[model samples]
Target: MNIVLTIDTNFAPQAAACIASVCENNKDVSSISFFILTTGIKEPAGKKLHTLVESYDRTLDIIDIGNIYQYFDSDFDTAGWSEIILARLLMARFLPVSVSRVLYLDGDTIVRRSLSPLWNTDLDSNLIGAVREPTASAERRKALHIADMRYFNSGVLLIDLDSWRSNSIEKTLLDYCRNHKAVLFASDQDAINGALATRIKELSPSYNYVNSFFYYPYSALVRMCRPAQYISRENYEAAIADPTIVHFLGEERPWRAGNTHQYRSDYAHYLSLTPFSNMPMEQGWETYFKAWRTFNTATKPFPMLRYRIITSLIPTFMRFRAAKRRRT
Candidate 1:
């Protein structure tokens, strides 16, 4: 089994940590290859990336997709979200024809446990296996006028390349970009969903537990809120109970400086194992905290606030109504 990880050069630090963790944690996994896909990475950063990968004796392949804006011109600044497109293009370019099976992971994720189960899961169903998306069907994705529930998250994927190539998944994604450029969300996520919605096999949500605390309050507080307990709502807690791989999806990522998400420490634990142990963890932590505060303070909850007020008043009015009705 060829374990493959795809990282965009923009997120090189987390990508390096991700690669290091993969090397340290899953030492038993026989074949491991790390690919850093760059549109245009600086030479110094590229050198550091090469050095880190070589230190572990892992195969490092750097695949460049030229300029990202050349293909995804909808919003040039939101290029960070284009990992899916670049990854697909990179796979087509570098993945060997002999590589029948491969796994693709986001750089933001920390591999806590083994990947063998996901790598070995039955893909006879002609599907790319991934963790099920954990947010409300209507919220996480744009309102696609289709079914209420969607198939899976794209972060941690166990791909059957034979099926992928046979089905022309890459071409289909690019085709969607060509045809429906208007409604495409900032990232290639919508394109992948459109192309592989029905074609994907839903892996356990534990594998790609999206860290949206607002949507998944239970998941957000699962570990800290319930130390002796576990819930099956999202993949992280489920994986904690029976861990194969745990993915940190959404804004509250582990690598960020002061992230409040439940599994931040879990990610830190893996990071500490890396050679950069002496590096100050607080630097990254502070950046995450600032971003979190900015997001929360700037967010307006008009609808939710209105609903809360109405809900709060309902019981009082109902009590009065019931008393009046009894007297009558």
Candidate 2:
């Protein structure tokens, strides 16, 4: 099966580790091919990543896409949503023309087990296959207008490359974004969610276990109940000991040498197996936390506060109107 991963230069070291871990863990599986889609980087991070893939000359291919904004709406931010766009772009341009199916993983991910299971899953002749995102509840399912309540995670996708090319998936997605710009909450993610709403084929949670951002209580409960059933510090260690893939998802990543998350040990384990040992990890968690705080204030809090104030006064105003109505 053709295995493709896309990453910008920002996560180059993690990307190297991700590719290396996959090759290392699945020793029996050497038939995989790797391709990288470089976005904002000047020189090729893909070429640098090739050295880490074990079989150097035979296992990897670097496709320098330069900047993706050429075809996308530059108004939206991709800092948080590049993977979705890169996966679609790679399927359109990087993989072999003859290739039918492709698996695209984020740069922060590490492979712990043989990808054969994920690669071999039937897409039911659909355009893509992916582990459903944990947060996509029945409410979100309805919001996406998909009746099955299954919304696939964009993090890891098993794409039908031939179908994508034949159907012009990239063009279709771009066109959708162009038409319904406001619908896109985070550009690539929201656009793809809007585009592939009902068409997605769902896989098991074990395939793409995401850390809950805002829904911590419920997501944490789910995690605690199914520690061994999915990905976490405990399961991550187990996976590393045996190793398929580990995805350091979201804004906070495990590749940073100073990353202090509970799962940092697991990341360090796989990091030991990769070429990133010499490179210094990025800035510490303080910077990450500050950025998270800043993002929340800018995007949600103030507006939410205003909504709360308005709702708080509405009950008092409604009571006054009720008393007046009785007097009338």
Candidate 3:
């Protein structure tokens, strides 16, 4: 299986932990190779990561994509995004023509079990296989001109590179990104779904069980994304019970020291196995307190709306507590 990840220096530890998780969990897979696309990763980080992957008897290809992404910087609305977002789309350009497929896992995801099923699923006619973004806003969908609103998250993609190369899908995505700068919300994700929402094969949520599953039930996501086809509640429950991949979406990631995510220890376990084992955890007790306190604010008046309201304030609450701690 060809697994790919694109990240910058800030995400090195995350990338390592994710790689560790995949190598540890997918032992049954015979030919697992990782392709990491980056401009430049600093010293021991690059060296140590190579060692970690080699220890598992796997090949790691680190490709430097250079400054090709700079062309998009001046035109796009890049509020919170980095250049790595643009580099992700250049996979078709960097990878060899012989490589027909790739499973692109984001730095924030962890593989908890065998990926053989997901890797082997036949993409009959779809350009790519992806999971629907549980909370794709209506406005964003409209901006992308997606009439059915079947927008997908680009985080964990099972790409059919053969189709991508032959069909000029890469050119299409690049053109869409260049032209629709005003409409792009999630940037690269918008480009993918905007051009290929109908063309994308919707993977089961179990393959990309986003963290939102913890706060909103499966029924709620079904209601929100309103996907034409969805899993039964029983299957949904089963997926939650043992997701093949756990995606840490939004701000509440497992890397934080006091994060309340169920997978914090799972992430830590993987991190401990990586070269960046000494990487210190960020945030503290205040983060844990603020998180749960805000989460409990879920109310009858637009439950998700209310949760977002409190969730937005958690940073302020944590800052106040941190200041108090420093004074003492």
* Candidate with best lDDT: 3
Candidate 3: pairs in clash: none
Candidate closer to the true structure by lDDT (higher is better), 1 or 2: 2
**What is the alpha-carbon lDDT for the whole of candidate 1?**
0.59
Per residue, candidate 3 scores C-alpha lDDT tens digits across 222-244 of 76665344567887787778788
Stretches off by above 4 angstroms in model 1 are 71-86, 136-145, 149-151, 213-237, 240-243, 273-328
- Each candidate's lDDT (Cα)? 0.59, 0.60, 0.80
Clashes of each: 5, 8, 0
Rank order (by TM-score, best first) = 3, 1, 2
- Top-scoring candidate (TM-score): 3
Ranking by lDDT: 3, 2, 1
Tens digit of lDDT per residue, candidate 2, span 89-198?
Answer: 44576567877778888777766667788888888878878664544333334444453544456768888888888888888787877776654434555556668765
Off by over 4 Å in 2: 40-47, 54-58, 74-87, 136-148, 213-244, 286-328
**lDDT (C-alpha) at residue 162 in model 2:** 85
Candidate 3 regions with alpha-carbon error over 4 angstroms: 71-73, 227-229, 284-292, 300-304, 307-328
- Give candidate 2's error at residue 294 in angstroms: 18
Which residue window of length 10 is worst by lDDT in model 1? 221-230
- Assess the local accuracy of residue 101 in candidate 1 as a C-alpha lDDT between 0 and 100: 76
